[model samples]
Target: MFFRSSKINEFRLWGLLFTLAGMGLMILGTSGIVFWGQAGKIFAGIFMVIGMIAMLISVGVYFWAGMMSTSATMLTCPECSRQTKMLGKTDRCMYCKTILTLDPGQATQHPADTTQT
Candidate 1:
């Protein structure tokens, strides 16, 4: 719940962060002209280029997430009674954060189990 989310959501979160960061960088680049007059253009260009790269990376991440999501297992969360997507053999409920798994062996393992060892 605190730091857990569906794989798809996690990817989306990263994409959102990248997008925000890129936008912020671009804004900062534009603002350089106001702060440094003519010399700011060089800094502005460099920042803008880096920002574009970040945005491109974000797009790639989003695309990868979308492709992965299409093949991910969809299940009804017992705890939340909501449909959620799960990646790999185990994942937590996106809404309720209840541990979920398709394998019987993994199903018995919980967050507490990891903390003990």
Candidate 2:
């Protein structure tokens, strides 16, 4: 639970970072950052392209995270007694970082998510 939560948080942060980077790159490319007449213009175009790609990738990552949220299993942490969502088979308590599982023997019997969107 904790691990999955942490990863989700990281992914969100990374998406924001990538968005910022793309904006920065686009700004730099549009501004007079490079000076070489035609060559400068070409460099700026390349930067713009790279920035667009980064923005697109960030959007995709965010979408993927949102989709995964629908299937997450929620459970109350025994250590911290707080509710948290588990993403994968290996999850920990988000509050106390305690390892959590469905069941030792029935670990493989975890239900598949049928919830859509």
Listing every candidate in turn, what is its Cα RMSD in Å to the true structure after a full C-alpha superposition?
Answer: 6.8, 8.9
TM-scores for all candidates: the values are 0.87, 0.68
Give candidate 1 regions above 4 Å deviation: 109-117
Q: Who wins the lDDT comparison?
A: 1
Minimal lDDT window, size 10, model 1 = 108-117
Per-structure clash totals for the candidates: 0, 3
Question: Against the unseen true structure, what C-alpha lDDT does each candidate score?
Answer: 0.88, 0.75
How would you encode candidate 2's per-residue C-alpha lDDT over 5-90 as one tens digit per residue? 54455567778888999999988887644566666787789889999998998998898777776677888987688887777666
Per-residue CA lDDT of model 1 for 6-111, tens digit only, reads 7778888889999999999999999998899999999899999999999999999999999999999999998889999899988888788888899877667544
